[model samples]
Target: MPLSRTVRCICIEISKKRFNPKSLEKLEIIPASQSCQHIEIIATMKKTGEKRCLNPESKAVENLLKAVSKERSKRSP
Candidate 1:
């Protein structure tokens, strides 16, 4: 009998580029953990409700994060 292996990371394929901010519904940031050593960024689309994994190291992702932060700050009282 062989031992069953379990998948660690939730993301199967990661997008090297960024998606349109207007089309994005939500963003989930998973920090580096024992299972996955790298930070994971998951985006949910507004229209399709599809989820995509984003490369945390990409410059586009950095800009997206900044934009989200800015928007959030403006919304805060």
Candidate 2:
């Protein structure tokens, strides 16, 4: 028998409704692919170093992403 090899989505269950942008240490955006059919947003908490999965379709998530992008652009030369 051959062993089937396949990548899997890291997040099992998405986190609660909202997150504090200031508390987010990092945000990782995973595009839809074979393993995961939908966009996945993962956030790392600054203090606890905990990871949380967020809903990509939420308005709050959109705003948080925009803010992070803007901040990064400002830092770039």
Report, for every candidate in turn, its global Cα lDDT versus the true structure: 0.78, 0.79
- Candidate 1, poorest ten consecutive residues by summed lDDT: 1-10
- Give the C-alpha lDDT of model 2: 0.79
Error of 2 at 5 (Å): 14
Error of 1 at 4 (Å): 9.8
Residue pairs in clash, model 2: none
TM-score per candidate: 0.68, 0.69
| Lowest summed lDDT window (length 10), candidate 2 | 1-10
Highest TM-score scorer = 2
Q: Per-residue CA lDDT of candidate 1, range 54-73, in tens?
A: 87766656777799799999
- Candidate 2: list runs displaced more than 4 Å: 1-7, 68-77
